[model samples]
Structure formats: C-alpha cells, structure tokens
Target: MRDNAFWIILQRLRTPLIVIVVTYAIAILGMVLIPGLDDKGNVYHLSFFDAFYFISYTASTIGFGETPYDFTYPQRLWVVVCIYLTAIGWFYTISAVISIISDKTLKKEMIKGRFVRQVQNFKSDFIIVLGYNRVNSEIIKRIRKANIDVVLVDHNADIINLFQLEESSMGVPVMVEDALLTSTLKDAGVNSPYCNAVISHFYKEEKNLRITILIRFLNPKVKVITRATLHDTIIAISDTDIAKVENPFEIFAKRFEIALTAPHILILENWIYKNADLADKASYLPEGRYIICGYGRLGKLIKEKLDKHGMDYIIIDENNVGTDEMIKNETFICANADDRDVLLKAGIESAVVLVAGTQNDIDNMSLFITAKKLNPDLYVISRVNTMKEISIFEKSDINWLFMIEKILINKTSLQISQPLKHSFLKRVLYKDEEWGTSLVNLLKAQLGDNPQLLHLTINEEKAFAIYHVLKANKPIGLNILLKSLANWQNYHKAIPLFLKRNGDEFLLPSNELLEIGDEILFACDAESREEIELIASNIYDLHYVQTGEEKRNWLLSKVISLL
Candidate 1:
C-alpha cells in the first residue's frame, strides 16, 4: 500500500516538478540579464526583479504595459536578442513539458529511483534491454559473465519496482518507461556513445512495431534489435536495417520441438553450465539400474543414450507400454510410475537414478516421494514446468531443471536490476539464430567495440582454429558451446571439449602447442571466447588444449573388448 501511494505521488509530481525547475532557471537568468540591461552610466533605473518580471511578460509576449524601465538603444538591442533566445527556449521547454504530461511513466520511475537508484554510474559496451522476460534476462547474465553492465526498461514498473526493493545491488539499474519515448530513452542514455539497445515485444505485436517506429525517430543511428513473432514479419523487420531482428516464436518453436523430441539437449545444456570438465569425459563406465518413469519424448531420448552407451536401465510403463522387445529382452516394470508397490517391485530401493519426467506436476511430485522413500541414496531428477514449483522440489533433494519457463525467474530478476543492458548484446543473444551462433555471441568483447557476433554454419566436426575476417580489420574467435545437464542428461552435455587436426587423425586439444585451423568447443561466458578461439585457431601458436584422441583410442579398445 505504501509503495502504491508513493508511486501515485510520484506520477502526480512529474510534470509540475519539471515545470518548476525550468521556470526557476529561466527566472534566475532573467534577473541577471535585466539588471545588466538597466545599467545606465552607473545609475540603475529598475530593480533586477522588476526588470525580470517585465522580460517574463515580454517572453510570453504580453502587450507592453507596466514597463519596469525605459530602454536605451543598447538596452533595446539586448531585449531583441533575449526575445529570440528566450522564445525558442520557452517553446522547447513547453514541448518537453507536454511530453511529460502525456506520459504517466515519468512518475512511476521517479518512485523506483527512490529505491533502486537506477544508472549508478554506467560504463561503455553496456546492454540496455527494453523488455523484461526470462530469455532476455538469461542473456543479461550470460553477457554479465563477461562483466558487462546491464539495464532494463518496462512500462509495467511493478515487476522491476518489487525487484529493486528486494535486491539492493549497486551495478544493476532498473527504470520504468516505454523506452520509445525520447525523455525515457535519453534518461537511459540511449543516444549516448557508450550504449546499445535491445527492444523486445511489449506483450503485443503493435507495441513492438510502435516501439520500433519511436526508436527510429528518436535515434536513427542507434542500433535497435527486435524479435518478430510472425515468420512473415521477419522480412519487414530486417528491411528496416535493424541491427538484429528475429521471429521470437520461431525460436520458441524450435525449443518446444527440442523438448518434445530431444529433451536431452536441454539436459546437456544444464550439465555443461554446471560441470565444465564433464565435456571431455565419456558418459559410459557407470554401471547401474536406472529407472525412467515417463516414457514420453524426454524419456525415450534418455533411453537411447543409455542403450548406446551399453549401460543398463529398467523401463517402467503402464499397460500396453512398448517394451515390445523390452518385455522379452530387458528388465521391465509394467505399472504406474507413482504406484508405490509398482516402484517397490521394480527394485526402486536399489536403483541408482530415478527420473520423474512426466508432464503432470502432481504425477512428477508423487513419483518423487515414492522414489525418495524407496531409495534414500538414489539420485532424483525431475523436470518442472514453473519456477514456483522449484521451491517444492528444493526440499526433495532432487536436481531441478524446467522446460522453457525455467529461464524466467532468474533472468527476469537479473534484467530488473540491470537497466543499462537493455540494448545490443542482450537482444542479439536471445533473438536466436542457432546454437552455434548463440554460443559465439556468448563470448566477450575484446580490445575494441562493435566486434562481430557470428551467424555460423558447421557442416562437420574437425579442426577449429583462429582466422582473420572483416577484410583483415577485425579478428574473431569462438569460445564455449554450453550444454544443459541434469537427470539422465549427463550423457548429452558434450562430445568432447576441443578438437583439432593432427596429421590424418582428428585429436583432442593437448598441452603441447596449438596449430592453425584447430577447433575447440569450450563452455564459457563472454570474456574467455576470444582467448579460447585464438588458442583453438593457433593464432598465438600456443598449444594449450590437448587432444584426447590417444586416450579415446584406448577407451574405445576397452569398450570393443567388453562387447
């Protein structure tokens, strides 16, 4: 209630406050000028305040009445110059006043500034995100990993307002406004030399177009990016020469399909972020009876990786579940995943891993309890639909990974505190192209600004090394390829950390020396991208990454002998 009242008061104060400040500045200038104007041979004819009032009337161009002082030729000339400048200044000030009056956002933000103290000293190469969402915020943290500054802007100030009150960070700044407005954008330093802009849809299509139009008018030179929802809209947005524009829903579709068909990918991504070294090692050698509850798309992929690696796991499904060959060849439990007795008969007590991957939150939750009771030492992993449920799973001693909604809570919180990041990099990173390109932009800015972020294609896996581009004016690198890890996804994190060519055989990165054209897949934030790229490309000729080929050969032989 107090916050609401505070915001209301702020909204009520914005226009009047601006008017008072401008009026006072003009009044002070008028007094100083009028006193100088009435100086006639050391005998002042009019008091400075009186002359000041007369000029105020003149600037308003009120008909000459009650003149404070008689004007000589020099004094009249000064009045003429004052008339033009003061008139122009008045028009500009009034126009600005009108802009503020028509906008309610000015006050909402004034209330926020009281708490978050937005823009607590901005720096170069900052990302300014125009809309707040999960993917957008994830982009902020990914960029922040490179140690760059971030800021967020939104018309719904309550979200950011609440965020500021909770987290008292000095670097992240949140502002409330439609960034399209010049006053708000300028406040955010949109036209400043050091800033970049990322403009996302404001919960509607028209707003995206409206914001785009407004940004162009306010700053034609500023780099603006947007994510188009309609695939048809992609061409139109791109035609505008926007720094970057994508069909957001297209990426959402891809992500949906990935989860629906190949959930291991997300699982791989999670694992990569958590364990950097897991990329170089094999997912095999661990022996256990893994229990998979849901035989849905996610469950199927988990089964495939388990089978490919020669590890044994039990598949449990209700009536008519396709253990087709499974009922004959492999150990299987045919019953509900949550039925306590079904899991008990399946030897849940001895299971090493239990995956509660069903879509129904209740079912997944129920399975969690049964699995926990069966095997206290069992590693439980579940996929959640919302962040709120994360708290529920938090106590279950289970590793939690969510679907698309997963990135929201944390990303939303991060962007709320970092308004400076509403611009270029944040938008580019989330407005997707593909995984490889996404990985490249995750790299940091190097010695200069306006560096190239890749839009790439990789046909085969081979040697990766440094190369020169941009007509030799710029040098570039590819850093980390992050994977999601959790549940049975421990298999999908990464194939190998880095790969390079050694004579005729492709080898893993080694400590000896780097060679040109050697490729590496590293998982990192922005800062390490270039250095890793140079190392992979052998730009500096440092053989830091060793090829794991020799070890893989021995490991492969052992696997062959086992088979």
Candidate 2:
C-alpha cells in the first residue's frame, strides 16, 4: 500500500516532469547554439557551462544583465522566446501538481498509506471497528479508555471529518472505505498478530456478515464481534467459531427475563459492567399481566420470554399483517399503541407491566404516558430507538429503559475487551436466584459498591514469580494469592470470581492449588488489584505474602553467610 501511494505520485507527475525538463533543456540549448559577443567584440560562442548559467538566470526572470557580454540581435530574440516558453511550462507543471494534490483518489490513497503504516507500527493489541456513529463512537471511547488502540473504517467522509475534529488524546486511525472489501480489512491490520478483534455493529445484517466472512479468511485467529438482528443471520454467523454474534433485542429480552426471575443476577451484571453501583437498590419486575406495544423484532423477543414463563400478556401493534397465525386468541390488537383507546382495549388499567416496545421513540413515550395516566402503579418498560431523545425518556415516568444502541455498544465492547467478565456474566445470568444473591452479597461485602475487574494468567509473561515457583514444583494455593503483600496474615480485599485450569472452569474457586497455566479473574478495589499484581509478579513480594518472610538479595545473603 505504501508503495502504491508512491507510484501514484510518480505517475501523476510524469508529464509535468517531462515538460519542465524539455523546456529547460531547450532554453539552455538555444543560448549555446546562438552566436554571441564578448567584451573584446570578437566572434566568441558561449561554452556549454556559461550558456547553461546564463539561461538559468534569464529563464527565471533574474536577468543577470546578459552574462559574459552584451548579446547580439539573434541571442536577444532567443532569450525573448525562452521567457514565455519557460514560464508557460512552469505554469502547466504547477497546475498539474496542484490538480494531483487535490485529486480525491490520490488523497484517499495517501491517507490509506498512512493508516496502514500506523497499524503496522502498533506495538500493543488493537480492535478494528467497522462504523463511526453514536454507538461506535461511544464504544471507541470505552475501548480507548482501557488503553487499547482502535482502527475505524467508514465510507462517509463527513463522519470521518467530524471524528477527526473531536478532541481526543488517544490516536485512532480512521479509514474512509467500503468495509465490505477484502482490501479494506487487510489494510486495517486484520491479519496483524497484534490485532485483538474486529467489531462490526452495522445496521445492515448483510454488511456485518460480509465483514465477518472476510475477516475469517483474512485472519482466522483474530476474534470477530459483529451484530445481527435476524435469526437466520445469527445462525449463519454461529457457523464459525471465531465469530461472536450479538443481537441487541435478544440480549435485552434475556436480561428482562433475568430481571423478572432473578434480580440479583441483574445486579451482579450491572456492577461488573459499571452500569450501576452496588449501593443502588435492586429493582425487579412485578409478576402480573403485561401489555406489550408494537410487535416488531424487539416486541417479538419480549413476547417469547414472557411466554417462556407462561405469563399473561397482550401485544398491541399498529398492524397485524403476519401475526394472525402466530398469535392465537384475540390477544393481538391491530391499533396504534399510543392511542388511549388501544391502551383501554389492552386492559392497561389492570395490567401490572406495560412495555412501550415500538420502533418510534415519540410513540413509545406517548404510549407510556397514556398507560401511566390509566394506571400509575403499572411498571413501564420503554424502548429507546435513538440517543437524541434520551433526556426525554429519562425525565419521563418509565421504570425501565432499554436503548438498542446502548445495549449493542455495551455488550459488544464488554465481549471484545473484557472477555473474562463477559464470560462470567453469561454464566451468572443462568444461575439460580439463591446462588446469585449469595454471590452478590459476598462481592459487595468484600469489594464495596464498585470493584475493578482484574484478569491474571500464570505465565512467564504475566506472573513471573508464580510461574517460576509452579515450574519448580512448588505449590501455591488461592489463599496465598489473596494474602496482602504488606502482611502475610492480612488478606487483600479481593475475591476470585472465575478460574480456568486445563480447559475447565471453576466459579468462585476456593483455596485450591493453582498450576502454572491457570487463569483467574478477580473483583477487587484498585489498590487491592495493584497489590495482587505485585504479589504475583515480584519474587520478594510473593515470598513475603506466602511465608511472612521477605526474601533477601544475593549480596545480603552472602554477607549474612560470612558473618
């Protein structure tokens, strides 16, 4: 790509360069061939060097006063011709150069070349995001805050320009190109070993699938996190192990289910993702009749979950074109959900839950307000289509708000950047209420309201001290890891949330012996996390934490032995 940019420059300037050379050569040749007179008034012809020097000044309009001597008529006439000839050639060349500089194709190639170089020079891991919108911009902000580099690909020049104009300390490379092309992916460093993952949360399912497919062939090892709304598209993406598909509607539905059945699990998820503090009281759904408005994708998913629990519910949509066969019994209403008549028809006055699940934000708000007017005690869940009207929704009387963009951004970012936390949350969502309550209480007591998640792998690169000790056949239990570096008897306020050893996972693993290749995920305060890192990586700290005796240096040991 770099070579291509250089070749483009050379190709564009080929004619201009030739014209300039020809004009200079012709001007110099004319000066030498024409006869001239020296101060002695003798028939003397200017040498090659002298003629070239004279023409250099004359053509440039410098006019060094007819170098050597006064020129004859023919010599002067040729000089007149040379002035216009050289000037015209210079003007033509300058215009051509300006045109090349302004060429959109050349500019794109140059930018691409620079982007490729930047991606190549990346020393740490980075993620390639496909689009640059409100959702992706937020995702980029979160990912960059974790100190990971990001490469963005979008076809909209205005959007790219807006991104560039934003004040950001982290350097993000943006490429304006079609993300569906193979070259675009290759240029975005999909094949780079440092490339951690590629994120494609495009609105179109086809684009996301195409990006996933291209990345699979480009770099099979790099993880591909993409979005798919359609069930068939999700199934197609599932065919590859390298791709992780995210459906915001499905995720929201499952979360709603968890909130209804096990609110503690939802609390744990919120705490882990930093969405809510542990100090906040847990909010759960009421078990009663539900009136769901709009039978779109999100509405359908919500209905499926409600049906799974055998809950009584009725769907109110503007039209019931394809829902006749699916919805038995006159439970489906063909009327606008925002209308007062529709709310009364759906028995909103007696319903315990009302979901404004339409595709329009205004309609959802109107529906919720009218439902509240009918039954202020009803628990309302509103779906937000865009972030522009978020303030309106927040101010409204909706009990639970779910925005598709936020759901997609948060889920996709967490899955790509913090895989361990993501995995832990997925497992926690399926656990029973009792188990979730116990775990949540444990975490809150130990780590406080908000805890930082830390991932550690016992290897030469991550935990040198632990790795060497385990390699020497020395056993290290989980309790030793939890011990504070300052005092062996005092333990750090940290708890292991998940542990992986030899392809097996143990949640909340107790004081079991840890091997060299074990991976542990811990939730603790920032200070405790830092202490844990020191204990695992520093030999002296590890020794102190384990045996209450600090390990001495070689020089001190030698002196003690001598004494």
Candidate 3:
C-alpha cells in the first residue's frame, strides 16, 4: 500500500512532469543557440549551464533580469516565445498537481499508506476495530485509558471524519475503507505479532463470520472478538479458535435470569466488569406475573428465560404477524404496549415485572411509564436502543435497564483487554449463588468497591525478581505478594482471586508456593497493585517483603560494615 501511494503520485503527475522537463529543455536550448552581445559588443552564445540557470528562474516568474548581456533581435524574439512556453507548461503542471491532490482515489491511497506505516511501526500491542459508532467510540476511549492503541476501519467517510474531529489527546489512526475486504484487514496488520486482536462488531452476522474466517486464515493466533445474536451464527463463529462471540440478547437474558435467581451473582459480575460498585447492594427481581412488551429477537429471548423459570407472563407487541403460533395463542396481546388499554389487557396492574423490550427507545420508555402509572410497584425493565436517550431512561428511574450497546462494549473490551479476567468472570457465572455471595463479601472486605483486577505471570518478563528467586530454588508463597513493604506483619488490601499452574486451576489459593510459570489474578486497590509490582520486579523490595529486614546492595553493605 505504501508503494502504491508512491506509484499513484508518479502515475498521476507523469504527463505534467514530462511537459515541465520538455519545456525547460526547449527554453535552455533556445538560449544556448541564440546569439547575444556583451557590453564590449562581442558576439557570444550562452553556455548550457548559464542557459539552464537563466531558464530556471525565468520559468518560475522570479524575473531576475536578463543574464550576461543584451539579446539581439532574434534572441529577444526567442526569449519571448520561451517565456510564454514555460509559463503555459508550468501552469499545466501546477493544475495537474492540484487535480491529483484533490483526487479522491489518491487521497485514499495516501491515507491508507500512512495507516499501513503506522500499523507497521506500532511498537506496543494494538487492536483493530472494524466499525465505528457510539459503542465503538466508547470502547476506544476505555481501551485508550488502558494505554492500548486502537486502529479503526469504517466504510462511512462521514463517521470517520466525525470521529477525527473529536478532541482526543491520543490520535487514533483511521482508514476509510470497507472492513469486509481481506486487503483492508491485511493493511490493518492482522498478521503483525504486535496486533493483539481484531474486533468486528458489525450488525450483520455474515460479515462478522467472514471477518472471523479471514482473520483465522491470515493469522490464526490473533484473537477475534465479534458480535452475533443468532444461535446458528454464534455456533459458526465459535468453530473458529480464539474467537470470542458476544450475543447481546443472550447476555441480557442470562443477566436477567441471574437478577431473578441470584441477584448477588449479578452484582458481583457487574462489579468485576466495573459496571457497578461492590458496595452497592443487590436488588433482587420479584417473582410473579410479568408483562413483556415487543416480540422481537430481544423480546423473544426474554420470553424464553421467563418460560424456563415457569413464570406467568404476557407479551404485548404492536405487530404479531409471522410470530410463532404458540406465542400468538398464549398470553400475547396484539396492540401497542404503551396504550392504557393494552396495559390493562396484559394485566399490568397485577403484574410484578414489566419489561419494555421494544427496539425503539421512545416506545420502550413510553411503555414503562404507562405501566408504572397503572402499577406503581411494577419492577420495570426496559431496553435502550440508542445511547443518545440513555439520560432520559436514567432520569425515568427505571429499575433495570438493558442497553445492548453498553453490553457489547463492556463484553468486547473485557475479553480483548483482560482475557484472564474475562475468563474468571465467565467461570463466576456457573458458580452457585452461595459461592458468588462469598466472593462478593470477600472483595468488599479486602479490596473495597472499585478494586482493579491485575493479572500477573511469574516469568522473566513480568516478574524478574520472583522468577529469578524461583529459578534459584528459593521458596516463595503467594502470601509474600500480599505482604506490605512498610510492615511485613500486615498484609496489603488485596486478595489472590485465581491461580493457574500446569493446566490446573485454584481459586483463592492463599499461602500456596509460587512456581516460575504460575499465572495469578489478584483483586486489589491501586496502592496494593503498585506494591505487588515492586515486590515482583525489585529484588530489594521483594527481600524486604519476604524478610523483615531490608536487604542492602554490595556497596551499601560494605559502607555499613566500615562505619
């Protein structure tokens, strides 16, 4: 692509360059052949060098007066012709240059060339985001906060331009091109070892699937994170190795179920994702008759979960055409859910839960407000279609809100930026409610509400001090990392949430002996995380934390002995 840009410039300006060269050659030749007279009236011809130099300034309209003598009649006549010839040639060349500069194809190639260079020169890890929108913009912001670079590719020039206009301290390189093309991905550096992951969250499942297959073939090691809402699409995407598929409907349904059966588990998961504070108490969903508005994909998924729990519910959608026979016959009302008559038909007055699951934000908000007017005690859950109206929904004080954009952003960012933490959260979903509650209590007790999740590997790169000590056959336990440097007797406000060694997993393994290749995930505050890093990388700090006394270096030890 970089070479393409260079070639494009040459190709576009080829004729203009030829014209300029020929014009200069003709002008210089005329000057050398024509006769001129010096002050002494000696007839002489200008040298090739002087002719070339005179034409150089004359063609540019600099008009450094005539050089080295006065011209004879024929010489003056030829000079006039040369002046206009060069001026016309220069004008044509300048116009051609301007035309090429304004050409869209050339501009795209230049931008792409610059983008390719940026990706090639990238030193740190980066993720390539396929499309851009409010969701992706938010994802990029969060990813940047973690000090990771993000490259964006979008087909819409307007969206790309809008994003570029935003006030971002760290500029994100963007390419305005079709993301579905293999060439686009290649230019984005899908094969680069530094390219950590590729994110494709297109609305079309087929596009995402194609991207996953392309990335797999191009670089099987690069993790692919994408979105797919359908079961078949999800299964197809899952077949590719290291592909993290996010189904917003499925995720929301599972979360809704957790809120019903295990509120604490939902709370814990939210805290881990930084969606909620650990100090915030869990609000359990009431189990009773429910009213679900809209019968779209999201609505149907919510209905499936409700049926799984064997809960009584009614679905009210404006259009019930092409819906399943069972749904049409069973507690489904064919009317606008926001209408008072529809609410009464759906038994909203007696329903304990009302889900405004429409794809439209305004309709969902209307349904919730109307339902709440009838039944003030209704536990309302609404689906927010766009982020623009989020403030309106928040101001309405809906009990539980589901924003598909937010769900996708959180899930995709978590999986890409923090794979280990992503894995831990996935395992957390399968654990029993009792286990979740205990973990939540533990996190709150030790790391407080906003503890940062840190993943550490005992290797030469990540933990030099600890790796060397383990290599030298020195025994170090997980407890050593939790000890404070100030006082080894007191532990830091951190906990070992998970440990991995030799394909075995241990949860909350305290006082366990550390190995050279052990991977550990800790939940701790910022201060504790820094302390842990110091202990892992600095030998003296590790020694101080391990032993009560600070270990001195060779020079310090000799000076102390002499003293």
| CA lDDT, every model vs. true structure | 0.52, 0.86, 0.87
Positional deviation of 271 in candidate 2, in angstroms?
0.4
Q: Tell me which residue pairs clash in candidate 3.
A: none
**lDDT per residue (tens digit) for residues 1-563 in model 2:** 35677889899999999998899899888888888877888878888898788878876778878878889999989989999998999899989989999998888888988999999999999999998888988888888877789999999989999988866424998899998999889999998999999988888898888888777788889888888889899988878778888888889999999887888888888887888977767667888889989888988888889989998888888764436654567678878888888789889989999988888898888888788899989999999999999999988778889998888888887876677777788888899789988888888888777878899988999999999998999888988888977678998899899987886888899998989888899988988899888888999999898778978999999999999
Stronger candidate by lDDT (1 vs 3): 3
**Candidate 3, 1-563: lDDT as tens digits:** 34787899899899999999999999999999988998999889999999998888988889887788877888888889989999999999999999998998888888888888888999989999999888888888878877898889999999988888775425688899999999999998898899999988888899999999999899999988898988898998999977988889889999988887887888778887877788888777887898888888888888888888898888888786435765556788778888998789778788999888887898888887788789999898899988899999889879888999999989888777776777778878877678888988888887777788889999999999999999999898999999998898898898898888887888778799999889899989999999999999999999988778888799988999999
TM-score of each: 0.39, 0.93, 0.91
lDDT of 1 by residue, 310-347 (tens): 66778777743756688787566677889988888777
Per lDDT, the best of the predicted structures is: 3
Clashing pairs in 2: none
Model 2 is weakest, by summed lDDT over 10 consecutive residues, at: 319-328
Better of 1 and 3 by TM-score: 3
Off by over 4 Å in 3: 35-44, 62-70, 321-330, 447-452, 486-490, 501-504
- For this target, which candidate reaches the highest TM-score against the unseen true structure? 2
Give candidate 1 regions above 4 Å deviation.
Answer: 1-142, 151-155, 165-289, 310-336, 344-352, 360-362, 375-379, 387-395, 399-563
